[model samples]
Target: MATSMRATINIARGMDGAIAEILLGAVKGQNLAAERLLALSAAEAPLDSNSGGTLIASGTVVPAAAVGDDSLVTYDTPYAARWHEDQELVDNLGRHYMGDSNFQNGRKSHYLVDPARENKAELIAIVAAGVKRG
Candidate 1:
């Protein structure tokens, strides 16, 4: 004769649900932070020519609030990329490229970075507030 035994296990009820809610709250907080950064960066961006106001208009923020979601802020116009990279560009007259000569220097537009640095404290506060709300 032979005998067999079976075992069963059960997790605490609502544990997974509680954990999921906590995670979702954190994600929402992060998204709010990203949005704040994007707005600050755009506001601080330099505007001289304002030809099409494309540089300022191109500012955007992508919120990450789910698994595999990556947050990002971007100045998405074609020239915006070059400007952000500190690359030289031809003048409106197409005579010469800016930043090649000393008069027109190719300098990194710290539009996003500068604001982030200047408002580090404020941003931290914002994040803290978000956490508290969450």
Candidate 2:
């Protein structure tokens, strides 16, 4: 048997702990506070965290959440004031999340949208894997 889980990984060269918390919380059906999502950067400029950032999550389980049978979890690169300006950053985030050891085992993954057909060049979710909390 398999259970659906919804997740979004935000990678921008920093911890993004608060943002992770928001995503985690959202999965658990919690309403996140405004401060939790405070933008660290505008469109032209990006920000890095002062502390080393590791992936953080909110909700029922730390890294995994129970999703509805048909829920779709989408991962769109962070939208900035100017979309095209951060192409490299977005690309790197997608590659790292897909290739990173943190997510390698257990779950199956796929690109939500093909970058080849889309100028957005960000990852969109086509499918996700069923995973157990470690």
Candidate 3:
């Protein structure tokens, strides 16, 4: 005669629960990282002495709600998009215009985009830090 043994294993949580946890962690991590990215991009943003530095001050981060959702990093000025696109007019409009602040150096055009691209790796790392590979 031959005998067989059977065993059962219980996961700490169900698949759906595990997935939800991971998504929560990722969302939190993304939000945490978004702050730093926003700050960096803002610092890199072209400083417009005109309009009281509106472009530099408009850097914003709209965080992701879910794993598949994209977190928006944007500026909230009317000319933000045009300025970011490196339009010549945006450049000439600055430089201590009337009530605006003095011209600022060390800022660059395409400021937000460039920093985001360069720091992509760091962003991913920050996101990854919240999840564990199974």
For model 2, how does the per-residue alpha-carbon lDDT over 7-113 read when each residue is reduced to its tens digit?
98866745576556544544433111111111111111222233211111111112223333223322233432122232233354465322322222221112222
TM agreement with the true structure for every prediction: 0.62, 0.15, 0.73
What digit string (tens of lDDT, one per residue) describes model 3 on residues 1-134?
89999999878659888888888888877876787788888887766666667886777789888888777788988767755665434245565323232225767667788888999899888878766531
Per-residue error for 19 in candidate 1, Å, reads 2.3
Q: What is the lDDT of candidate 3?
A: 0.73
Please name the candidate that would achieve the greatest lDDT relative to the true structure: 3
Where model 1 places Cα greater than 4 Å from the true spot, the runs are 1-12, 48-52, 87-108
Candidate 3: segments with Cα more than 4 A from true spot: 1-6, 88-103, 132-134
lDDT of 1 by residue, 87-128 (tens): 476668887555422212232366677777888887677656
Candidate 1: minimum summed lDDT over ten consecutive residues — where?
A: 99-108
Best candidate per TM-score, number? 3
After the best TM-score superposition of candidate 3, give how far the Cα of residue 123 lies from its true spot, in angstroms: 0.7
Clashing pairs in 3: none
